[model samples]
Target: MDVVATAGHVDHGKSTLVRALTGMEPDRWAEERRRGLTIDLGFAWTTLDGGRTVAMVDVPGHERFVGNMLAGVGSVPAALVVVAADDGWSAQTAEHVAVLDALGVRHALLAVTKADVADPGPVLADAVARLAATSMGRVRGLPVAAPTGRGVPELAAALEELLAGLPAPDRSAPVRIWLDRAFTIRGAGTVVTGTLAAGSVAVGDRLVLGGREVTVRGMHALGEPVERAGATARVALALRGVAVEQVARGDALLTPGAFRATSELDVVLTSGDAGTLPAEPVLHVGSATVATRLRPLDAGAARLRLAAPLPLRVGDRVLLRDPGTRTVLGADVRDVDPPELRRRGSARLRGAELAGRAPGGAAAGAELARRRVVRAADFTAMGWPVPADATAVGPWLLAAGLVDELAARVPQVVTRYRQLRPLEPGPPAEVVRRALELPDVDLVPAVVRPPLALREGRVVAAEAALPPAVQRAVDGVRARLAEAPFAAPDANELAAAGLGPRELAAAVRDGQLLRIADGVHLAPGVEREARARLAALPQPFTLSQARQAWGTSRRVAVPLAEWLDARGVTERLPDTTRRLR
Candidate 1:
């Protein structure tokens, strides 16, 4: 679906033109109709000649309601510019056109309304000439006597042509619905409506609103119920688990974790009257209005400090208008997540680098991926869908070169650690993650491929050799155990044989020692022989019976029996007697 909003001066027949086009009353409020002026956003739509539907968002044209007007047109790709033939172009016309230019709205249809009441040709030519000066230059115009039957069909046909040429919405992208209205229905609980800028939403898909999780109870697209709705469609979503008070205009409903909201931005001034913007302006983008502070960085570059968190992307067109005076200064978002300017001349240095970066496309995306391991959400937030050529590790998008580097470094790091402190297990994932400077610690094991493996939660090379000291200690412990196969050494005895806790653990990891319990250690082959003797004993033997059968002392028998029971090799009876598995 294509959504087109109306823009023009107050009482210029914007709502009248919409009513004539759609045959539906756009002014929802009773006060608006009584006063003959639009006070807030209004909605109406009509089916084109060939079954194509155009959703018309009718915005108030009064200068006082310009903020509300901005909220209406912020996301709509096209605008229906209504100028009354009698009134000609007015001050509000210039302001609205400036706003449209600041927002980069390039497509428009000019309707010289109330043609029957005045000479429409001069006003039509004037409106066209004025539009040519704004960002919405090259607009198609027609004189429409909306109250009468003049030129409505031609205007509708022109709208159809405009809708046909609109770029298809990216339905596969993550959903970001910048809410413009939030209210509770009599029976449907809480609902919010907005233009779905990207991706799709289904009946049960999870979405986040201001960091609070909400579930979709129902959905309506262009006033009709739907189980799913795609991008570029005006949608009303009935949400559960969030109250109407909690959700307001400017808060967004988004695919959870796929978007990040931030208050700071670094932007390149794509076009504006002032090289340096006013200190505090009303920053408008994607249905959001924020009180913001601007700092000029360099030529065509500046920084913004916003009052609220906004989910933004690199290269996004944002309008900077002084809130008190309402003068527009256009900007293109260079970086949505900006670094702090801690020292003098930092903004200029960063601006120089951003100015050199590509605005959008494959080259720019690849450069972004190359700098660090970023989440898939970061890519979405930057206004780029995840590239097909990019490599993903779970939620993280790793540069192929970074993955290769980490893969190559993992074995080398583990091998080095093992050579130095072989008595210990492999390096913890955090250590390797930090060493590699990876963004996510979870990527540690992801790089440890085939010849590498994770052991006891630490990444280790498959054939890592033990340290010489640990190897020597292991050998001495083996010799001592071999001298008396049934006699498991005590801690002191194991220490005397150069096997402290560290060495003992290393020997166990290397398959030379079997730890029955704390202070109880056995050679690898001893457990099998001990279990065989237990098998030869009478059924349901007592601890003393097991001890006599194994010919070992109470110290060794207790842990062995317990270990056997824990391993399911033996079961203890109701009366505490032992039974083999």
Candidate 2:
């Protein structure tokens, strides 16, 4: 089915236009007819001359009902922009256009209704010119007098021609249906209705909501039972394990994990507030909204602070609305920030990057959004219907490529720094910490030792080898130790040689040599022998026994014993008893 939405201000004849085109009243609820304004989404369909069905979505026009309007248009891949010829454009006309653009509605036809009231030529021309400027630029205009019979058939023909050019909706992808209505039939338990969106729902198939998978008890279409339903099809489903109290309007039905959650991301605001640049707008991706605070002080690049968790991806176009003012601001989706919240003003988004991701493909935008972590607030703010229980969120996945690059670069940084500053192995663990930024806590451990590679007070590894002065100092220390048995040249003694405490620490850290303890250094063979003898002992013994066992003095024995005790190799009792664990 080719779905199209009707948009205009309240009482501006949107329903009349739909009714004229479809020969069916779109106002399903009695309240809707009484008020003459659609409070909720109303669905209707009509056959074109060649028997092609055009699913018509009658969207609300009141600013108060913007949420309903979005829900109505969100399901429609195409649209019929209905503008009362006498009223021209209202606040809702621009808002509706923005909403449609944000939802990625690219194909549409403009229906100028109430043509009999005034000369519609000017209004039609304006709508056509504006349509030519938007993503839905190819929008054709038809002057229609919905109350009379003016141009209704011609408009239908034009709509059919417009839809015919559109490729069939892809229902073969992941199942995602944005629910517009939810209720309980005493016998049915829970009944939910929405456009089938994508993919077919079969008998007993799992319906994932809020991370909980429910079974499909039955399905219905056009007031009749059906075996399965697909994209662009209005469907009502009786789902197992779902309750009327638990389900609400604006909730979505999707396959499990079809979207993931995120905390922070990079986005470019395309529609601005009051002549402001469209670099960043408070974004709504899928079933969530985000308060996007621009990074680096609103310098075109921005970071989104989510109100809730949501599933999102790169190129996922989201609806941005000014929360306080309640007007459409603009649309944008995931970019820059992948899994990590970037430093404010650190990076900017490029249109080419987003375009490359979207490429005018069906799933490209959503696929890009999927790879990213978008919070629930973003979707909600964008007028998406998020499931109430859907809260599994956060900690977006970092691309393996970026991770791998960092992993490879860390050691190199350590080596280079060490070589450049020969007198030092590296800055304090904190000093080296500036080299790379990490996304989350889990990544720290996998990169190196627990948390990160740390030494002294700094968190950097030497990227370069020890400098000449430090290298010579290290060689001198080794030379002095080799020349004399148990000769340990202190850092002060090697001060003229240029190696400092940190340089010696780095060499020891790199495992090129061993430090038995403070003021002590030893060869690997000697250390191994000392370890073997200590391992054999079940208790701490006198200095004489240790001397006879390993042939070392209090110089090696005391420090070695302390190291073992620190490692829990042996314990010291109150009575001076030492026993190995």
Candidate 3:
């Protein structure tokens, strides 16, 4: 299925041509039908030659409804541009043509309507020439009098040819349906209609809407119920778990986690002069219209700050229109997640940087180079193609040379950390991440070099020697414990020797001393000797018996027994008696 939108001035017979082609009434409101003006968007579908189904979105042509017109044509790839033969080239016609061109709509066919009232040749030639200068390039023009059925068949054939030339829609791409209508039905709950520009949606599929998940309860394509619908088809979805008032025309139904909502972006002006752009213009993309502040960075580059966030991606074409003058500037999104301009002349510098790169042609490598580190999921969600050379560190993608750069800094950071805290193991992974300004703590291991290693959860030097003063104090404690193996140093004695909690902890981490309890410290090998002595005791011996066997006091015996139990070397019975395992 293919979707095409009608573009031209009002009363130029856009809805009429669509009605003639599809044999369906496009105008839904009684006031519009009586006035013969399409105030809002109208929809109709027809089967062209070769049985290709085409959906037509009849957009209003009046300047008052230009927003409505932009919403209808924003996502459609093909267009049927209407021009009244008698009216010739009107102001609204030129505006619509400029819009189609700015949007990069290449598949188009001109239909000079009201041919029965005037000779169509002049207007057909004139409109075709106008379209030729735009992105539509050279389009085939046909004179169609819908009321008389003259040239209608030829126009349909031309439309079929135009639709055939369009690039095939990617059904596997992420689903992003910009809804044009949202209303409630008596039994259906909430129903929203939009063109499925890419990807596929099934009846049971779950889609993201305004940060929450909504179930596709039912769906219809071309006014008929369908279990599934693919790209380029006009689809109406009955959504579960949402109310009609919660949704609006600009809301998008998306494949969950497939898109990132951005409130700011960098863009390249594809049309219109950036120098003359208004400070605040209305940005139109898909069915969304947002108030934006445009900052011109260069002649062709600019930055936009949207009043609200939208699920935008790289390569999306957006239209910026001054609501007061209705002047539109076409912009191609270069970066959806752009860096902040903080320093003086940063905006111009950023523009200079962006000018060197092609808009929407940025590869993943370019994005990685710019960001240095990004989540793998965010990279995919932002519509960047994951490159083969991308350095994947867990869920993160690192830029080229980032790992080497971080690795080089790791030892320096560790040394500084050790100097700040003389009696501590190397910094934890979180500390390293914060010191390096890394995005994820998990990436710490990826940047750790040969001399540096992650032990347990902390980043440590491979041979982290204790400070000389703490080492000497630990050695004194070790020598004392060697003489009286079970007689661990008390806190007062360790403090007198300049061994505090931190020094003890450092000694334990270095494997030079063992910490039996909070303040109790012993030689590293003393626990093994104690365990052997306890094993020689009777089965299910009491704590007092174990203490007597190891020649240790009650303060050391209880914690030692608990530590042995924790290590699975011994079992403590319900009566508080212990046995060697």
Alpha-carbon error at 223 in model 3, in Å?
A: 0.7
lDDT of each: 0.82, 0.65, 0.89
Residue-level lDDT of model 2, residues 1-581, one tens digit each, is 66778888885798988888888999889999998888877888877887787778788898887767766775567888888889988888888887777576788989888899988999999888887777787678989998897999999999988888887766666677767778888888888888876688887889676567788898987667988877768888999987777876556777765555555655555555323523344555433344554442232334565655555555455666665666564445544244442565224333334333432333332432444323444443332334322322253333324445555666666666656765455544333335655434344334443233654444454343455666666776777656543445555675666655676676676555578787666654554455567667556665455555665567766776677678776676676555656
Instruction: Report the C-alpha lDDT of model 1 over 230-304, residue by residue, as the tens digit.
Output: 878889999999999898788878887776687888887667534545778779887788998888777677788
Error of model 2, residue 100, in angstroms: 2.3
TM-score of 1: 0.85
lDDT measured at residue 240 in model 1 versus the true structure, 0 to 100:
93
Q: Please say which candidate is ahead in TM-score: 2 or 3.
A: 3
Give the per-residue lDDT digits (tens) of candidate 3, residues 219-311: 999989999998979999999989999999999999999999999999988876787778998999999999999899975899999999999
Task: Choose the strongest candidate by TM-score.
Answer: 3
Model 1 residue 370 CA deviation (Å) reads: 7.0
TM, every model? 0.85, 0.60, 0.91
Q: Distance (Å) between predicted and true CA of 367, model 3?
A: 3.5
Descending-TM-score candidate ranking? 3, 1, 2
lDDT for 462 in candidate 2 is 37
- Which regions of candidate 3 deviate over 4 angstroms? 359-364, 468-502, 518-520, 525-527, 542-559, 573-577
Please give the lDDT score for candidate 1.
0.82
